[model samples]
Target: MPTVWVLGAGQLGAMLKQAAYPLALNVEPVEPDSEHLPNIAADDIVTVEREQWPDTPVTRHLSSQAGFINADIFGRIADRFHQKSMLDDLAISTAPWRVVNTDSTAQEMHAELGAHVLLKRREGGYDGKGQHWLHKDDGGAIPADWLGTGIAEQKIPFDEELSLVGARDKDGNKVFYPLTLNLHVNGILMASISPLSRVAHLQSQAEAMLGKIMDSTGYVGVMAMECFRVGDALMVNELAPRVHNSGHWTQAGACVSQFEMHLRAVSGLPLKAPDVRGQSVMINVIGVERNIGWLKIPATQCYWYGKDVRPGRKLGHINLNHPQKSVVQTALSELHTLLPQNYDQVFAWVKQELERA
Candidate 1:
């Protein structure tokens, strides 16, 4: 049995645990504050969330048998400026971007890019938090206490955002999952459409990009890239050094799920090419409750995370599938009808929609 120690017992780790079981990969998750770790190889140690492990004393305990992965490259690979720098070094075209360190720097950056910008910390920020939009005349309200260092970049006006998920094995062999078209609601991901129409073109770009990123970090395992489409150009938006939210549609939509791919990559196994059959639309369950009669649409399968539900929380997600592209649109339309409508809308947009629907 090949035993691997995974840091972070969070949702990603838990899901990876589930996926690895069927593959006979022994995965042990050691919480950041855990006092004990089962006997695991040092080179075998991987991280479900790499950014959280750095600066923690537990890293000292990562025995020689274990090797940290999704490594401490968060600061090096996750930031927009760093990513752009890497892109420039590799001669890739991305949205024109600049990094701002202070309010004065913001002005110079604004002049270089635009009035509006996307501001985020250099380190950790996810689920639509730790990021703020900067307008032309706003006072500097950016919190100084963001997780670690902070960065800012020009927000590109693009038609849509695309995300790609892929993995590199111990031997540097890489395999990519199908490209996915993403939809976001209020900065949080709401839906994902997989095996996007332009998979080949996007796949080539993503593989080259990931290869460069992984080479820079000496990283092994899953990495995802978010890209923005403006006219005919694909501009890289951001990179996640792990399996991503947009790729979750693969669970029931493909022969090789991303979690299993991460497992294969980190544990030195053969990478399986994604075999996408039917069209899939993955809808996120956010700010939603089971008591709301969360509609179980036909051709849909639910994946509920064992997490405490909260306002704006991602409790779980559902992947609604159908054989042809026609059913996909129908499934989405059906799900839209099933969601609850607010009655507090007598003077609101719902009242207008009520007359239209």
Candidate 2:
């Protein structure tokens, strides 16, 4: 088997490495900034954990390699400006938006988009960083530096935020997991649940939207699409070109994990829709020390990233799943005392979702 090389040795890369072990595949997760580059054979496949990365010697080398997966698709989707444009060109629904430049004015933005606007950096920004909210009441001017470096979008109201994680292979075969209901607190994902019984009606629509993107780009590997549930319709919020945080629950819930699916797709392995089992909840362990108490709960699994903990940093994630909804609920209830008070809202949201008849 050819080696699989992953750029950006973060948690995603680590998980990918773990996934490859069971398949007897060699996977290397390289630090993006490291000056030394890996020896690339003609059959070795290259992929990225991050949508955007700084241009460095190692990155330059891997990007130029013939075996790189989705190398041409990353740059186009990395910039929010081009991403939104592509969505528009495809007739996909997204919030009204425009590129912010030197001559752009707040009045014009409000008039065109709405009284409320969100400015996102065109380049790198994730986990809710590099964003500015402008409201009519605040009465502020768009920062001069943000011009030409950001995309301004109307702050449209939506019933809920959801995400779809799908994978497409070299043969153009595609498979998608069920739509996942997500909860974001201050722009950071706090929790997510999948195989939702209530939103079953929207699954195919979500898949169609994401399938259009992957098919258009000839994208190969796992891709995540974040969306806004507006009434009976869905609007695209952002696109992740690689495995996404929202899909982490697949580690314990699906027949094939997202990490494994990504590896399979990029390596010319057979691809098919994974058999989803029962209910799955993923609680992001942000900025918290790992606690052994989490293991005490039944049907609960923890994946600690082994990274230094800081305020707002993604330390790890906890996955809970069971064939019975009642069992999953009971386990979630058990986690209340084990985790910090910060997770109170997350559990509360989960409770509401479980009770959704």
Candidate 3:
């Protein structure tokens, strides 16, 4: 059996593990901060999260000794600074941004980019962490701790947040899933609507942009690109070099899930068509107990990560799939009525999307 060593035992890793079973692949997951490393064989496939790439010997060995093994480039374009620079260099439309080094001051950046600016840590920032929003009315002082490497971005007034999850293989073949409309609560993704109809006109453009990025970076495996839809134009937000939260709906909605697609790409298996039969709405279960009762709902699939509940943590997700948009909308409405507080943001977004549909 083909054995793959996954470098992070988080939710993504666990999902990948589940997705690998049908392919008869053994997925060995190792915690990112584990004190000891696993024994590796020459034939073992090494897959890593972007943050853990620097510490994986298997990835290092495979990358350095080119002829020995094929390794996915995890960290190259995962860094926000690198992603921004690359997109800009390629003439891709993204929010106007400026890198802030030790010599750069937030006040100066604000002066240049305007009063309303977003300061983001260049290396590690996700789900609204390591981010500082500065407004002219709130005093333009920069935080002392955020003085290191960062980027100052002009916040765009967007109509909706959008994302596309896709994969490319070694032979240059590519497959893109349907565009998704995402809703964020406190900068964390609250819910998503897949195969978005309001923005159907932009799917071609989004896919072409993703294809360009994959070609330029020689990207293999699944990748997600978050974007801001400002009127008719879509501004690139950032890229995640792995299976992403937004694509979780694919598990039940698509013929080939993102987790399975990622494994296939990295394992050199032929890429499968990302065929979608119906619409899907995914809601994140944040800092909550595992509620298996959701499984009882028709057409609902619950994915509960076996992790302790903590504030702002993504404990699990529920994906609702249906062939009819009205059925999906009705279910979503009933879900909202059942748990009004928990599904506040999600229900609102789902309702809006359904109305637009």
On lDDT, the candidate that comes out on top is 2
How many clashes would you count in candidate 2? Answer: 0
Question: What is the TM-score of each predicted model, taking all chains together?
Answer: 0.84, 0.99, 0.93
- Cα distance off (Å), candidate 3, residue 162: 0.4
Residue-pair clashes per prediction, in order, are 8, 0, 0
TM-score quality measure for candidate 1: 0.84
Model 3, position 124, has a per-residue lDDT of 76
Instruction: Encode model 2's per-residue lDDT on 1-357: one tens digit a residue.
Output: 999999899999999999999888899998989978899999899998998888899989889999999888998999998999999999999999989998888888888888899999998878999999888778888988888889999998899999999999988899999999999998999999998878889988999999999999999999999999998799999999999999999999999999999999999998877999899999999988889999889999999999998999999999999999899999999987888898898999999998892
lDDT (tens digit, per residue) of candidate 3 on 67-110: 22224345556567887988998899999998777777767877
> Which pairs clash (backbone N, Cα, C closer than 3 Å) in model 1?
41-65, 41-66, 42-65, 42-66, 42-67, 43-65, 43-66, 43-67
In what order do the candidates fall by TM-score, top score first? 2, 3, 1
lDDT of each: 0.69, 0.92, 0.81
Question: Of the candidates numbered 1 and 3, which has the greater TM-score value?
Answer: 3
TM-score winner among the candidates? Answer: 2
Off by over 4 Å in 3: 50-72, 337-342
Q: Tens digits of per-residue lDDT for model 1 on 35-115?
A: 764555544555665554554445556532336665556566756567678877877667676555544355565677688
Residue 33 shift from truth in candidate 2, angstroms: 1.1
Give candidate 2's whole-model lDDT.
0.92
Backbone clashes in candidate 1 total 8
